[model samples]
Target: MKVLVTGGSGFIASWIRKELLARGHSMLVFDHQDRRQQLADGEEFFLGDVRDATAVTEAAAHCDGIIHLAAVLGTQETISNPRPSAETNILGSLNVFEAAAQYNLPTVYAGVGNHAFRLIGTGCYTITKSAAEDLARMYNLYRDGGRITIVRPVNAYGPGQSVAAPYGTSKVRKIAPSFACRALAGAPIEVYGDGTQISDCVYVADVATAFVNALEYTAVHGPTERPVEVGPIESVTVNDIARLVAEQAAILTGREPVAITHLPMRPGEIPNAVVTSDTSTLKQIGLDAIDFVPLDEGIRRTVDYYAQTWLPGYLAA
Candidate 1:
C-alpha cells in the first residue's frame, strides 16, 4: 500500500511513518515546513499546506490511503489564537476530506478522544478538532463512498517530542517536554491545581501502531459506526507524571529529584481527565493495548531521551 501522511514531520507522525514503512508500505509526506528530518529510502516529501485544496489533492494523487495528522498543537497556543487554529485544524481537515473524496481514497484521521464527550470547557483545540471529526462524518455521508477511519488517541509522548516551539527567542511550552526540561535543570516540577488532573499518556510507538492497524482495517472493512479510540487503559494524574519525570531525569542527569510544586490551575482547564476507549472494538480491529508501555517506563525513556539528546545542548546555549 502507498500512504500519504499529512504533517509527517510532527512528533507522532514521524513514528507513524517509520511504522508504516516497516510494514512494507510506500510513503509520501505532505507538510508545511521543509523536511527537517531525513527520509527513508524510497520515501517522498512534498511541501504544501493542508489548507490548500489544490496542494492536498495533488499530494494525494499517487497515494492509496491517507493518514491525516497536520494541525496547530498545544492547548495554550490554540486557546490564545483561535482563528488560525480553526483555519488550520478544522478547515485543513475539510480540505483533506475533499481531496480524499475526489480521489476515492481511504483516510485515517487524527482525533482527540477527549472531544467525544462533554468536558468542562471547550478550548479552541478541542473545538476545532471536534468540528473536523464532524466534517469527516459529513464526508462519509455525502462523498462517493470512501473509507474514513477516525482514530482518537490519548496524549502521545516520547522521544523526538518537542518541549517548546522556537519562534525567535521565545518558547511555547508543551506538557511532557516542559516537565523534562525542569527536571533536567534541577527546577521544581510545577503541577497545576493540586496536580490531580488525570491524563492518559500513551507512548508514541503504540499510538503509531494503532494508526497503521486502523489504516489496514479501513482498507479491508471500510468505515465503522464510531471512531476507534486508541491509548493506554490506565490513567495517571498530573502529580504522578511530574514525580516520575523528576525521578527518571535525576537518574539520567545525575541530579537530585526535583520537588513537585503546585500553581493555580489555568482557566478553562478540566479538574480531572480520564480517557476511555472502546477496547472491544479495538480488539475486533486487531489492536491491543496489552503491549503498551507502562507510564513509569515510558516516562523514564522520554526523560532519558530528552536529557541525553536535548538538555546538554540546550544548557550549553
Candidate 2:
C-alpha cells in the first residue's frame, strides 16, 4: 500500500515509517516541514499542512490510504493557544477525513485516550481531540466515508521525542524528554504539582505498531465500531518517572542523580489524574503478540539517546 502519513516528520511517525517500509508498503509523507532525511528511498514526500483542505486532497490522490497524525500538540501549549489547537486538531482532522472520503481510502486517526476521561480531561487539547474523533465517526457514518480506524494511545514516549525551544522544534514539554534531557545535563527534574499524576506511558515503537495494526485491520475488516485504544495497561506516577530518568542518567553519565522538584500544576492540567485505557481492542487487530517495552528499559534508552545526541549541545548552550 502507498500510505499518506501526515506529520510524517514527527517523532512517532518516524517509527511508523520504518514499520511501513519493513512491511513492504511505500509512503507519501505529507507535513508542513521537509525532513526528507527521515524518508527512505522510493518513498514520496509532499510539503503541505493538514489544515489546507486542498493540499490534503492533493496528497491523498496518490496514496492508497491515510494515517493522519499532524496536529498542534501539548496540553499547556494548546491551553495557552486554543485557536491553533482547534484549527489544527479539529479543522485539520476534518480536512483529512474529507480527503479520505473523497479518495475512498482507509485511514488511521491518531487520538488521545485520556480524552474519554471526562472529569479531568476538560483541557483544550482533550476537547479538541475529542471533537476530532467525533468528526471521524461522523464522516464514517453520515458522509459515506471510507474505513476510518481511530487509535487512541495513552502517554507515548521514546528515544526520538523532541525537546522544547532552542533544542528542538517541538514547543510542547513532554514528560519523558523533559526529564531525560534535564537529568542528562545534571539539572533538576521538575515535576508538576505533587508528582502523583498517574500515566500509562506506552513506548513510541509500540504506539506505531498499534497504528499500523489498526490500519491493517481497517483495510481488511472495514471501520471499527468504536475507537481502538492502546497502552501498556500499567501505570506510573509522575515522580516515579522523574526518579527513573535521574537514575538512568546517573548510570549513563556517571554523575549523581539530580534533584526532583515540584512546581504548581500548570493550567489545564489535572493533578493526580489517572490517565489509562482498556487495550483489549488491540488484540482484535492482531497486536496480541507485542511485548511492550517496560518503562524502566524505555527510560534508559531515552536517557541514552539524549546523553549521546542532544545533551552535549544542550550543555554547551
Candidate 3:
C-alpha cells in the first residue's frame, strides 16, 4: 500500500515511515520543510503544507491511505501563539480529513491522550488537538468518507526528540529531552511545580507500532468507534523521571547526579496531571502481543542518544 504521511519529517513520523517501509509499504511524505538529504527506496518526499488544501489534495492522490501527523505542537508554544496553532491543528486537520474523504482512503490521526484531561490542562495545544479529534469523529460519520481511526498517545519521547530552542527547532519543552540534555551537560534538572505531576511516557518505537497497528486495523475493519489509546498503563511522576535521567546520565558520563530544581508551573500546563487510559482497544487491534519498553531502559537509551549525538556539540559550545 502507498501511504500519504503528513508531517513525515517529524520525530514520530520518521519512525512511522520506517515501520511502513519495513511492512512493505511505500510513502508519499508531505511536509512544508525538506529535511531529507536522501529518500529511502520506497519513500517520496513532497514539499507542501497541510494548511494548503490544494497541496493536501494533490498529495493525497495515488495514495492508499493517510496517516495525518501534521500539527502545531507544544503546550507552552501554542498557548503563547494560539492563532497559528489553531489554524494548523484545527483547519489543517480538516483539510486532511476532507482530502481523505475525497480519496476514499483509510486515515490514522495522531491525537493527544491529554484530551481526556482537558479540564486540567486547558491549554491551546489540548484545545486544538481536541478539536481535531472531534473533526475526525465527525468525518468518520460521512457515509462515503474514508475510514478514520484516531490514536491518542501520551507523552511520546525517545531519541530524535529536539531539545528546546537555542539548541533545537522544537518550541515545546518535552520532559525526556529536556532532562536528559540538562543532566548530560551537568546542568540542574528543572521540575515544574512540586514534581508530583504524573505523565505516561511511551517510547517512540512503541508509539509508532501502535500507530501502524491502528492504521492496519482501520484499513481492514474501518473506523473504530472509540479512539485507540496508546501508552503503558503505568504512570510516572515528574520527579521520578528527573531522578531517572540523572541516574542514567551519571552512569553514562561518570558524573554525580544533578540537582532537580522546582520552578513555577508554566502557562497552559496542568499541575499534578495524571494520565489514565484503557488500552483494551489496543488489544482489540492485535497489539496484545507487544511489550512496551520499560521506562528505565527507555530513559537509558534516550540519555545515551543525547550523550552521543547532541551532547558533544552542546558541551563544546
For each candidate, give its TM-score against the true structure: 0.94, 0.95, 0.96
TM-score-wise, the better of 1 and 3 is: 3
Q: Across residues 145-195, which tens digit of lDDT does each residue of candidate 2 receive?
A: 567889998888998888985456677888888888888777899899998
After superposing candidate 3 on the true structure, give the runs of residues whose Cα lies further than 4 Å from its correct spot.
Answer: none
Model 2: which ten-residue window has the lowest total lDDT? 116-125
Candidate 3 positional error at 97, Å: 0.5
Each candidate: what lDDT?
0.82, 0.85, 0.87
Task: Compose the digit string of candidate 3's lDDT tens values, residues 36-154.
Answer: 67579999989999999999999998799999999888777777788988999999999999999998899999998889656666678789888898888887775486589998888
Candidate 3, after superposition: displacement of residue 225 in Å? 2.4
lDDT of 1 at 185: 81
lDDT of 1 by residue, 255-306 (tens): 7899998988765466665556655557746877877888888988888888
Best-to-worst ranking by TM-score: 3, 2, 1
lDDT of candidate 2 vs native?
A: 0.85
| lDDT score for residue 191 of model 3 | 90
